[model samples]
Target chain A: MMEVSPTLPAWVAIVTSILVLLGAALTLIGTIGLVRLNNFYSRVHPPTLGTTLGIGCVLLASMLYFSVVKQRLVVHEVLIAIFVTITTPVTLMLLVSAALRRDWAIGDPSVPVPPGLPEEAERPEPLPESDQPTS
Target chain B: MSVLTRRVLPYPLLSAFLLIMWLLLNQSLSAGHLILGSIIGVAGGLAISSLQIPSGQVRNLHLLVQFAFIVLYDIIRSNIAVTRIVLTPGRVAKSGFLYVKLDIRNEYALAILACVVTSTPGTVWVNFDSAKGELLLHVLDLVDEDEWTDLIKNRYERLLKEIFE
Candidate 1:
């Protein structure tokens, strides 16, 4: 058995423990929110809470631990953070858009597309007017 | 040269990110690492150029910095609050989804917001309606739907609009 160093900074261990616990707790809350929300759109908020801050804390703890132990700036974990930050919204957006399209196509009462907003907003803008005029 | 620059090194920020990631993962700053990383980054950028992802230009540096700091602080606070709820067990409020009407039309901005929401511990980004501009999110804590909407709109969306839109 490897001997544990008593000289290890107490704050690091303490902070790590707290962050892990926090991450776990936030995950639970997100799950709870999923169960409690009244509607499909309403239910979507909580899970994000867990995924964002939960993962953020856990990553922070990992970064802190590795950096302290290795005595180097170990930030490779930021890649995960960045990737998560970029992808989660995209997945959610796609899913939401799909759901909305389904609702609109079916003329579902619960989901209503606002009257003022144009469908064109949903798609990328057309090529510049200058280029089109030339054609 | 034009072809290489236009396709391969189209997005400077993205290439820079790739290079940084390569260096970080490899944990080296040697000449070999820099050269290899730069090659990969430029190549990767070229590969992505065809996808035609709408290029977003960020204008406000101050707002972005503020946004980052705010998110950091919120994460810390939420972590504490959420951990307490999880440990308590029996007292958890029922969870459910919220439909939020959004004023934000920018795909890139909305995407960033979704990531922010999903990565947080107590929330999940379930779906969004592009045509309707509605965001469907699942919450672990179902205390108030309006509150969540307000939080997203005020806390994150506002800054995103300022920075990206």
Candidate 2:
């Protein structure tokens, strides 16, 4: 088994440290946005920020640090980036759609539901076929 | 060939991206890894065939690069600004949410926009009304809703339109 070196080059350490701090700071801002922003829709942006670029930067730093310290290419971080990029949209879309559906149900004037509900929602049950099958 | 090329890999670029990503994360050029990664990539390509995601052909790659640079700079600047506000002893009043209309409609493009907005410091993508194309965003320091709106529409949206439209 190979072990990662305990110490990193001065430049590598400095760069990684700076990146980590930058990532952390960005994450903090996202959270602040989460807290400070008003309304449900308005609040959606911050966490996406934290999860996307915030995670992207942090993951990049990790990849760099491990690659350097371990003397081997370390790159699993991209999986996270991929996952975050792909899933954020789906989760956000679901949440937004859900919120919209609730608003529509409550008759909130602001929300506009699709002709019948957005494609995702379960449709109204069709009337049971008349007892006799039509010829 | 066209079916696989156009329909299966609707976004050859994105599929290529996934391939490179698999290699990077696995951190090996071993034949085993390459074969496995290729299988996964092909499977993924096939899976997206059902999504019917609209593909945007990027014309000016240069502008897209410029947009990336701008986002990087803004993230750094906002991070510093937000940190100051959070660490300050006195509770500085900072609260604001603004609704901005969006012009882009591609689901993939919108997803990218959401990621960009959320990833940046001091901003969040709270909600978007798909039917009306209105987005509600919360800014940590709401000194100016107009400024926030301008930043998003002019700064981000313009670049995104150039890249994806």
Candidate 3:
């Protein structure tokens, strides 16, 4: 495997190493939290650290290393950062909404059903007789 | 600008952003790249203009910058806080759901606030009720309910109101 040359400036190497280490360590903590946290709701909070700052630090390191090596700005890493920043919330929102829907369906007391609707009424109505017969 | 061009390029800011993004992605500032990026940006902007999105005006640019720095600082601080929470074994942080009543009525601003809150490590925006202007947030380390409410209102929502309302 190719390695970063030892001849590079000390600051560049130090910054890159620090960023990479911090990012990796944060990501590890996030994954561990996923397992250690007692419930799904609480578990949702930790992985976001990995997604937000974990990837952010790694991207920063890559940008700095490549820019120093090539002697030109390497900011395309920003595109990924921007994309992740926008999309992660979207996916998280969808996942949380789906989880909420499931919990509501199962009549989980902790999960609040939307106001003015009973738990059973919130569930999808059964298919028509013809559709049900086919299934 | 002509009426036709104004209609086509309804989102001039978006077009400019796309053009800059294209140049950055290509990593080139040559004339050829500039021309191509401009064309693509204008086309993309025109395409999106068909969607008829309601434009939200940003009232204060200085406040927006301050808001960005505040978010950055909060993100770093929360990253450390959450990392500690995760590392310390068998220590259960007092996590709970809290409902916050928001004064900001602009949808675009509310969406941005949600993204910022959810992206921060310790808080997740679980659900928002538009009817009541209330947001449900799941906080990992819920020490004081009033503290969370005050933080959200004063730190973020106030800045967002200045920016988007």
Candidate 4:
């Protein structure tokens, strides 16, 4: 069994472990912000931490580990990095825009009425202050 | 010869990008993979005609690399900053939406800026009113609105304008 698997150097293993743990800790903290933050807009901020640096660290560690194991540069992680960086923003933008539309339709005061569609913003009579998302 | 190939490969950069992507995904540099990647590149580049993707002319490739480094550094710094914001004992980070007018009109530049803003830890891209050229940014650690506006306009906008417009 030992012969089948290539032996990893102590330093590489240590660095990879540290990077993996750090990435995990960052992602966990980011998600914690999602649950912990009082407002939805604020909640959106934390998860991005997970998507950006969290995946970044983990991919870097994996690239290093596999590159060492293969005795060559293993950089397929670049693809994942590109995809994540591009897609996260696209998805986040869509989600935020959709949420904003819904809030505006419902006359949620927490979100400022959008400037682009003044008609839609004016259409909904402002809701009572009795209910608001956690600010 | 140049004109003929240009007709076949209308988007040379896209072709190269697709080829590189194929090579990276397969993790190989063999002859078979090279030929296959070329095929994919050609097909993909031609296929893009089906979609109406307005191509923006890139001005300075060198500045693009430098801009990428700046973004990377910012991302790392913001990661630490956000970590602090989340881990701090009792106080919640002061978060709010901010509105700033932009001068960049190129759609490609706008898209890139949006990605950068949203990907950064503390700031999220909420909305952009193209008609008004206004950006609605949700900042987690909202302190001074002017500071954020300057950061976007000067740090990113100046460089992006150089690159895209």
Q: In TM-score terms, which candidate is top?
A: 4
| Residue ranges of candidate 2 with Cα displaced over 4 Å | A1-8, A14-61, A85-135, B1-4
User: Which scores better on TM-score, 1 or 2?
Assistant: 2
Candidate RMSDs in Å, in order, are: 10.6, 9.3, 5.0, 2.6
At residue A111, what lDDT does model 3 achieve? 66
Location of the lowest summed lDDT over 10 successive residues in candidate 3 chain B: B49-58
Q: What is the lDDT for B21 in model 1?
A: 91
Place model 2 in a CAPRI quality band.
Answer: incorrect
TM-score, B chain alone, candidates in order? 0.90, 0.86, 0.94, 0.95
Summarize candidate 1's per-residue lDDT along B53-91 as a digit string, tens digits. Answer: 778777898988888788778766665655555446466
Superposed by TM-score, candidate 2 places the C-alpha of residue A128 at a distance from the truth, in angstroms, of 40
Best candidate according to DockQ: 4
Would you estimate the TM-scores of all the predictions?
0.68, 0.69, 0.91, 0.92
The 10-residue segment with the lowest total lDDT in model 4 chain B: B48-57
* Model 2: chain B TM-score relative to the native chain B: 0.86
Native interface contacts kept by each candidate, as a fraction: 0.51, 0.32, 0.73, 0.85
Q: Candidate 3's residue-wise lDDT over B22-67, tens digit each?
A: 9889999999999999998899988987787887677888988888
Ranked by lDDT, the better of candidates 3 and 4 is 4
